[model samples]
Target: MNQDLIQTFIEETEENLQVVEESLLDLEQAPADQELIDLVFRAMHSIKGGAGLVGFEEIGELAHYLENILEEIRQAANPKLPDDIFNLLFAGIDLIRQMIEDNDLTAKSVGRELTELKKAIKHYQLVTQEGSSDEQTIQQQTGQKYYKINLKFRETIFETGTDPLMLVLELEEVGTILASYLNREQVDDLFHLNPHLLLMNWTIFLESEQSLDKIEDIFIFVKEDNQIVIEEISEELEQWFSGGEETEKLLRKEEFISNVDLDQVLAKQEQIGESLFLQSKTTKEETGQADKQVRNLHKQKRTETIRVATDKLEGILNDIAELLIAQSRVKELATGIVGLDRSLQSEIVNSFQEVDKLIRRVQEEVMSASMIPIGDTFTRLKRMVRDIAAEKEKDVKLVISGEDTELDRKIIEQLADPLKHLVRNAVDHGVERPEQREKLGKPPTGTIELDAYHQEGSIIIEIVDDGRGIDKEAVLAKAKEKGMIEQESQLDDSEIYNLLFKPGFSTAQEVTDISGRGVGLDVVMSNIKDIRGNVEVFSEKNQGTKIKIKLPLTLAIIDGMIVRVGGERVVIPLNSIVEFIDASKQQIKQVEGKGLIVSIREQYIPCMALNELLQLEGSFNNLKEEPTGVLIILKDDQKQIAVQIDEVIGQEQVVIKNVKENMGQAEGIAGATILGDGNVALILDVPTLFKLAKRLKVG
Candidate 1:
């Protein structure tokens, strides 16, 4: 097999598996839905056929059994499915996924699990068939019909190890082969022939009571490489064959066709093949070449786009970044030149401006291409919640919103594990059982909502549940018991709730598969923070718990407001800055020895000197020393704080380079960027700065 063909098969199989997983989740909710059943059956059936073509026998077998169960259900023989059936099917899905990932088909690897699933399926099918005798009887009343199948194998079919004889054998299992015509005129003489090449076509007249879907399934393994045309010809085909002399039916002794008629049809097919072959052989070589060129041009016109590897796109971005840095340096040099011609300087500025615009446009296009919807991650979470709920014997419904919202590919890739942990936590610890919920006058089915939306150039994801909220008392007791917090520590409700994220701080009575090793939420927080994001929890006694995470739009670049903190430069994200103000002495008042509070728009906001917060040398320690210090009013969602600075420089779009990799996460700093003058300025994390200011005020 070609490497490209293998990669394409892997990508397509994974996509179809996603559909299968989603449809199974939907079927768990609406067991009687025919469309959902069909969707799942089709997805699994496709995977089975495709995997067989690629020689992944384990995946093909798993999908085949799973598809069989779904087919029985669709036929109304298994109306009241047992809950265990879903488990078996889910196990089949996992088994197939693992096989695809490892590319293994050894019997020792998946034989036990495969046997268990098949056993359960066979048992259920037997029981269901016993009760569905009447349905089977009605199905048999639909008499057998004849189908004419024309199969022309692609020239390269032998390369894929596809034996046309196997397909014919499969057809024989379904019905009687009345007559057949084999076209082998394309076969060359033994001296010139390619032994591994396929040069034959087959036309078969088959009589079976099976539906067209079943007939199509016979050739599903080779249908893509072989042209298969199946049509119902029970009525019209008889008249055409009745006029010709037939011959002996070597394969079947059925009365459908006599020997004389079969011989006559074979003779006619040979004459037709010879005439077409001779006509093609006599065509001028130039004319044939011209026709081939026209076909190639037509194919090129049809395919307008092609897939490019991610690394190639990353290379383009790296070149663009370098170009941007050089552009900045040229602009800075242009500004510093003295005694230059005014017109030439002006043209240089204009040209730089135009280049800047073009660079931005290119950056946007590349970023847009790199973005994909968060829906795939959301779907995976839904399946996780469903499986966990089933295991825990809970009735839960997951509602998702803003699934079409797109995010940077890098951000989305790291998002899956964190999101999975959060959802599993919700299912295991937050949601109450049906019995408990009914006693509390709530709906028997609990609801968990997964939502995502864009806010101020960031993506906010919230997981909200309608189960019994976090037990603050239990959390506090656990913290005290684990020596995580002092017994006399003064903690508010938010602080108490936040203790859930402390390492090894779980309150569950015992460890289970879902959660309770006390490692999930802390990992969630750490993962979110690695992307320069934050997660907060809110809960009430009986209402529920909500975990909201805020992440940046992208990892590489952002628009920032550059400012001076007593001669040192720093960058604050533009999205977080509300406005700048020149605060006078009287407006800044100290509360005891704590930080200053600046009055803005009739509201008092905590004010801290940026120099003091960052603790830098050669910085103003006192806010009142300056006649009128600049105050940057920053907001993070609903919280606001003021950072007093010496000067407010202009804003610019800066490329963010990670500082944590070298500096290891500085306080009040998210990352660093280069100024136009080639100076490195630290990017301030507004949320962290707000928290620092609050601690300063409370001290």
Candidate 2:
């Protein structure tokens, strides 16, 4: 009932569900893998137990049913499950996720689906049982075993939010209790006892058809701190039962025969206990040393990682940004102090330099803390691809690489939708059906690869598919039909490919549920651009399509090149700048169609004066008019353009401040940063800048 406990349960359950989902995917490929099977079973078991602890009976029931199915599969002679069963398991996971998200104790939102899923699971159990009846009978006859389990739990177990009774209940599920004894020797006087402390132990004799390993697993969650001893008493019980009529009567009475003098059996039990005690003594000595090492490693790991709220991290970053600005102001004021001692000034400069280094280090560490691996996102994508492939009846496989590449958590969070749209587009439109692939001399199963890696100063994510590539003519034809492009417009391959991102653009011959609503790619572009990133498509007919997205490592800070554009100082991302050229060294010409073109080497690129493009005041309108003006060439994946500026200031790392809330969207302006002297400089969005220049020519 505690809110904190519920939250902890939810977090832990979510993690276990992820494990279950991923393990199921793996098990689908290698069905006979015992380790994968156990992994999934353990995850599901943990979820079920946690749900019970949190009083979510609906969740607990669903997980319990799914756990039973997993147990059946684990025990089956042929481990490979039918596709329907896998589908059922995936659906169950989805339902459980929905219930958790809804957090409705009454389960009103998912009642129908929950009922249908339970029915399907029950049907599966009946069918499997019918098919394996003979095997089950054989196992029941020959595999029956008895285990004597002694459970002495830690007195402080209740404080950990664990009920010792839960373990007993779980053991009951695996087998039947032939006899159980409550050991209350540890109990204190009732008046003096702490009610919260667990003081009772259980000694149970169980009859089960499961393996010893399976029985041992029932105690896995508690065995670490508890004194649990399990021994096979099957042969001993059988011998005693066959020895005399009196033993048979004792069994028939269903009572403990405490007065019976079975010396051999008692001696055997005592000798075995002593032998086990000695063995455990030796094992404990070794375990004690290993436990110390493990504890040290765990302590180090705990210190290395701690969970901090995102808002708190953002606050730290904001404070650090303020400190950086203050440090710069102090340095600037120190330089202007007249009649200061040379040594003192030198010391002051060195001290500021040290502060700069320290601040940069701390900034890097904080940013690193906000980064998480993209593997989780990729895992979710894998599931999406599986479901979509199934829905469309296409044989598609998603291969992932560089999933461990870390990205800013905020960026990664916003990235999911865009990536999902692109991936769905790939599966729905890019990949061909199995029969079509086979007819085209390709493997029936198509492959879609999701890859991520760091390139230059940005993170590049590429989704590539080995399917029928983007049909350029179809795209261009659609564009023409939709009046998105001029009918007679001359365009190259890249230009044709770019048309896919035009709003309301679709090349599909007919509409389907998956795509062809003329809605996906444009949204993908808009979303990526919103994060100051760009998306590009590359394709060759019949070879496949590759969509690559380039994004900054973090949105907080970046290394930028400051340049004077008229009276205002602008920050251009250093990664986008190809080179700086002197206007005097280049042959600047006014080509009739190209407007202004600057010749570098043998290639001519379009040129635009920043002051002219931005319509800034106080500087010459043309680059040729200012003798000291320079041109900075910037390149994106598709095109390159030269922007004319007054003078190049030094480069510096600046913290980005979002100005969209106050200023609204500004064309070609990504964000603004505070300069050392307290002035705000606008950062240019390179891709948009290139587009603006192209539009200027048309005007």
TM-score of each: 0.82, 0.83
After superposition, the stretches of candidate 2 with alpha carbons farther than 4 Å from their true spots are 132-144, 150-164, 176-205, 221-229, 236-305, 338-344, 578-608, 613-615, 621-627, 630-642, 661-667, 691-699
Model 2 TM-score (2 dp): 0.83
lDDT of 2 by residue, 535-646 (tens): 7788987889998898989988888999998789999999999999887666677778767887788888888788777667765645444435788989876478888888
Clashes of each: 11, 0
Residue 3 error, candidate 1, Å: 2.8
Residue 584 of model 1 has an lDDT of: 64
For candidate 2, the 10 contiguous residues with the lowest summed lDDT are 279-288
TM-score of 1: 0.82
How much lDDT does candidate 1 score?
Answer: 0.75
Error of 2 at 319 (Å): 2.8
